[model samples]
Target chain A: MTGVAALPGTATLAEIGEQAVIATLTAGLPPAADVLVGPGDDGAVLEVAGPLVTSLDVLVENVHFKLGWSDPADIGRKAVAVNVADLEAMGARATAVVLGFSAPPHLQLRFVRELTAGLHAECAAAGVSLVGGDVTRSRDLTLSVTVLGGLEGRPPVLRSGARPGDVVALRGRTGWAAAGLAVLSRGFRSPRAVVEAQRVPQVPYGEGAAAAQAGATAMVDVSDGLLADLGHVASASGVVVDLRRDAFEVPEPLQAVSAATGADPYDLLLTGGEDHALAATFAAGAVPEGWRVVGEVRAVGPDAGAGVLVDGRTWPAAAGFDHFGAAR
Target chain B: MTGVAALPGTATLAEIGEQAVIATLTAGLPPAADVLVGPGDDGAVLEVAGPLVTSLDVLVENVHFKLGWSDPADIGRKAVAVNVADLEAMGARATAVVLGFSAPPHLQLRFVRELTAGLHAECAAAGVSLVGGDVTRSRDLTLSVTVLGGLEGRPPVLRSGARPGDVVALRGRTGWAAAGLAVLSRGFRSPRAVVEAQRVPQVPYGEGAAAAQAGATAMVDVSDGLLADLGHVASASGVVVDLRRDAFEVPEPLQAVSAATGADPYDLLLTGGEDHALAATFAAGAVPEGWRVVGEVRAVGPDAGAGVLVDGRTWPAAAGFDHFGAAR
Candidate 1:
């Protein structure tokens, strides 16, 4: 959903104040039965159906996102989507979320209202509720979202469960978001789909549970590039993963962006993060529909070196997003 | 516990990197049965005993707190304490907390470690677990804490249940923290107890459940000053709360701070915030032990005005912390 556009004479946060801004941001959110108590209380009460699953992600103004590069609504949507991906990785359906927002006092109140609208839209798409949150003034804009999900009678799919001979499968596209970033960084206009991918990733949400039901041994959401994230599963399971580069064909859109920007398509596909793709280890020949085989889990060498190998070679260390060490 | 002294050779976050920093921050924390899955996964899995009570609060440097005025450990502890207070207001015991931290890349790794130590110490104090979190790089320091609690088979004590003839009671100190803040703001060395009160409030954590069991009608934590928070109860319950000035005597420490700072004692007592005290209304003459009677809840006036009345008159608006409107 497109959030309400900023209008002339829209009150700034300083002019209208915190209470009024909060009242506007929380107004007209659809109520849920699980949310016995909503915003404005000390805390919220949720009647979770089963065990609770949770994840948290923080988005800083320029570190995780650039305000000029994305709309306020898209920022809010992306914030929710990223946290929801964590829940899906655990084979849980998101039930509710609480957001912590900080912004400057002179910021437009309309921005917060629109951001909330976007949060509502994304939560609706993921079948989650915006139950409660806290808003405060800061020097820059920051959004912290914590999502809660319910594991309705299914065992959690952990990253440490893959066994030797398990086949690694991928359920969503890779490199599109990174390709879009390459286009934007170079001051070139890319296809709308590529740009949207960079802004708000469309996670294959329910497939996580489907994979679990289909007997996936281990699962992880690809937030830190395909190789880097799968390396987590490999390391945790004490196995070595050998990925076949040929298994992943460069998509036409990414190829176009690579030609336009003179960037390597393989770099985007292998090292680009925030794809939110589901990568899992399933029994050989048992990969679920909508998922394609990408690699195989094997026993570690006699030296006990556990890692992700592309065509049986070691990849670079720190190949994905490292918040403190890497330059954005 | 005193945090590790910043050594001459202390590593900066950039040098230590995100992965190593995270590893050091999470090492050796106690585990809990409810935490079926802990950090290092996509999310944490919590076997909530019953209904889930959750709240979120974000503390920004120079906004909600100042690094110069507070120790990093105390800042971490206070962040968890304030959020736990919200759950305590709901007659819940905190079970787990998730934290989101953002800071500049050049920040010391020891600072983050000490912050985590402070978080661990506070969570241990409250019998809660630090389940999972996310960290990123930002221009300024910010900590967002989300507390999850359980009601333990009891109904949540809501703010909307106060009826006419209910007596208002308070379970903890009112003015000490605010007085401490006054002293800190004035750049005067306050008493150790007073300064500590301001930095890390000692909440009457379990008194909320006791109040519920004792038939308390309405409840809230006195975070935004006595009168302001009680106003929430009054508005939610549609009843007028009248607080008597003579009923509360000026504490000796507050009186000393008032004399030293030349601030009005009544202003500090009435409008001071961050006390983390439990304020509730119970049946008249049936207030529980450890609670001092402060006021009474009465029916709305013939004019239908429902709010907190001090000495039978309306208090000034914006008397407490309003993040956007207040002149801090």
Candidate 2:
């Protein structure tokens, strides 16, 4: 690392080197009970149990978000939220996360520090530790997070476990992130709630374990929109998901966005991605408090294939977020 | 994901969508006994014990390696090697790895498939499984690997465990990768041994556990040169690492490269990064059979702060690779 510390104004990562950047990122990170040895070591030693669940998610510049629209701190927070959602989707307790960050040398040190702040903040909110990670130089800024999870003694509530006559319920926001994205895309930002929701998802953190304890038979996070993610459950479980039109009452923020933008509120609710909401199927009466019954799982009919149908039709727009489908 | 299958010639990831690409990368991945569930889920459920060790490493295009200098498969294999090395550094057996990869939309489908091949082959060699990961679109190709390992009721060998009078030893090749890099930089790629080392490091697999079992105190993989990495151990342990000049026997390939390129062989051996070799501090008589003694851990003197010293002075050249310090 450079002997000179990164000064306030014009300091870039190239001038300070990697070791210094790492030191800045890991400083004051929250400690966890499972972490025996955290950052500054070759690897972190965590007190974990068998049946550990793990997932990885990557967020890249321009592809995932434009720096012009979202703050660096928000990007950092969103990265952690999106990754932890996978653990939540599996009915596993979000344990710890390790971030792999790389950016151009010329990127401002301020951005890096702000991103660190966001990561630390989100980790605290999710009850997960930012245990350890790698930082290096790259052509563009990218945050790759790998989240570890614990399934305790219960079996993982898989996407393939949905059966006929099961009730599909959801906990957490749906159309809000898509509405936020739509608002941002149109160069409007007045609806602060939706905009913030787009910037950082309000993931239902503890509801994964709650749903598992409630005897949820199947689960999937609404990362790729409510309809698209349920489609995953439908395809995996070989069933048909019939979502009721009246079940989705569009929230006020989403309704406002819909009224102004001339977009369908139901479209946003059905096909929005990046919400990170928990969607699980349970027996008819097994639905827990704070969750609403949105749909029902049914055996695939002879005429119908295994898929998600909202009032017996596929989503009007594309199903959820497609990374490569979007033009950068 | 696009329903159109990737039908070989000239197909790119964008055309097929993320789901297809993920399915392609995860197909036929070798199963591990510890893995309760593999890819295709929201996350992988790996059966592990407490005291789990984990580390994340990222490799980016242009910064980490050039497409011209190495094949796609070699890049994938090297990515795993570099990450698994961190686990091994802690004397933990490499268990499973989840890769977070992103690449340009125009990247060849063939390249993606070949990289998967390399990743699988290396995972098999290291006795690890490719569990699960996320693939997205990015401007530059990046492979972010997070490796998980189990401690198996043993304590981790940390870099801070070195004490005064501990003998320093090395278990794998040091100068070869540097020599290979030097060779490649000069537009000549003959010396196959050194070139291959540069492409994919044959890390002294299983030696980390052996060192730990033999009561080796402190250890680190020589990823960022012997001097620079040992400098980390010295700083962490608050000791001076005094290395012997005659202790290092420059290999024939390094000698040849040194003779051909006018680069110092010893300097390459001492300051070259990315060797992925294990360096450890052991008691004088407790040095393992495969490792050769190179230095001794000494108490920091008043004249010298905690750092690595070659013979009696610092090396002539600047210490190992500083990512941002290099000219891209």
Candidate 3:
């Protein structure tokens, strides 16, 4: 793109148009070493090696996050964070991300700048770069991020590899984001940490490779709640997972949120999703440090069905978020 | 996801929901060897070697297309095609794509299935696979496609490499799609070929590597108008590109389209975009077979400024599309 003159003041995208906005968005961004060709080309070229791990996720305004509830920066960070969590789940180091941002024409240039800044900040935290992306006009805000990662030659830990007798472990906190969502939905002034977690939850990024180094068999991000996501493992591995709720040292902030919202904290921990924690199965005595064994995998007996169970019984909780279901 | 029983008859997404719709999408799709882990996982693992190439593009409803004006399958194919064009422009062998398709809850499942089928058809034509993706509900239909390609040990042809004395060559037809768009915009029942061209314009996919092999200095897809996109080449290369309008063999269909719509055929040939044609700069007489010489790159003389000019004069025509501009 020709270096269009920057508009004088805070103008809407419609007033300044796309070319100027793109020029401004890309201005002064640090260049990446691995990116052979950066933005302004038809596409970006990267110096990638080893197995390529990729994931795509789309977050829509109002549906994914209400503009009134979170900062533009928080929304951008969350979009990158959730996609990065997927790459980390597979024991991959994220190298790059490509974003597709769609917004209304009347959207302010300031909002776009803030969103881009947030994306840059989150990518820096993960040691990745925004190599390329596209932007367009839409009726509402839309963010679609595709993350590319490298396995560094390690075999990816697949969900089907979890064997019976493996220990089910969890990394990172749970229920905080969901509880934060609960507080926000009710317009309550909840604990700051809990509320912040809901806005931009942190994933245990490095623990995936650590778990893999420690011989973890299978892994997934706890995006769809502990029970629900683990259920995917059980189905794929043909094993039953039994969780011990008492093993989890539920944080006091979550408990306070439960008290404030009058919602069961344990219930939120069990079923509320968007925590973006790393959950994996490791051989007994092989669970890595900074991880806690929360459950165990067992062969599905004829009398027992293969699914996630709590205390050797079916868990009585909501079944996590479903995009097209009544709950979400 | 539980194997929810299918709702009989053609059901809307709201009726069958996301799980069932995803099931329908992934079912009966052929497997690819490069894909170690496919859909249903947090991310897809691709067995990619060599330098990686990636590009992202988003097509929003009413902004990029209208449902009433095009078939859902055509829209899907167009999305995949446009992303594939980016890979082709970089002289990379297109390998795989991940899609993020968001639509309103009331969208029909049939429409989604048709769209996916079109994507599969187009990807198959390019010898690539739909490795994985995500779907969500939205206010308007949005398709964000990320294409992955391999450089296969070849150095990429960058836009900055075009030097004075290079010949500007183009492969594949130009202006057909833009002419087709004109016909559609005017609500005219133009030639079927022109209308189809507007919907699913084909690119000379294999010609990118061919151009690179023939010592092409720089290359890009003509997504924007020839002069405008070539202006990018000029700005990047620090040279002026002068087009010979007489050199282009404007296709008969475009001529027919122009006659029917009362549009200037030459203007359409020069400024119409979305042709997915490959334009490149090569040393004189190095233009590959099946490619036509359209222009020449020259140094910025004291009397002539750098940028795209037509037949030694500046052309008077609209420069391609701007997503956030009023015309679009």
Q: Looking at model 2 chain B, which ten-residue stretch has the lowest summed lDDT?
A: B1-10
Alpha-carbon runs more than 4 Å astray in model 3: A1-9, A326-328, B1-9, B326-328
Better of 1 and 2 by lDDT: 2
DockQ of each: 0.71, 0.69, 0.71
Which sections of candidate 2 miss by over 4 Å?
A1-6, A326-328, B1-6, B326-328
The 10 consecutive residues of candidate 2 chain A with the worst lDDT sum are A1-10
Please provide TM-scores, in order, for all candidate models, with all chains considered together.
0.95, 0.97, 0.96
What ordering of candidates by TM-score runs from best to worst? 2, 3, 1
Q: Give the candidate order by descending lDDT.
A: 2, 1, 3
Tens digits of per-residue lDDT for model 2, A178-225:
898899999999599999998899999989989998999999888888
Error of 2 at B196 (Å): 1.6
Model 1 CA deviation exceeding 4 Å by range: A1-9, A316-318, A326-328, B1-9, B316-318, B326-328
Clash pairs, candidate 2, are none
Q: Name the 10 consecutive residues with the lowest summed lDDT in model 3 chain B.
A: B1-10
Cα lDDT over the full model 1: 0.85
Q: B152, model 2: CA deviation in Å?
A: 1.8
TM-score of chain A of 2: 0.95
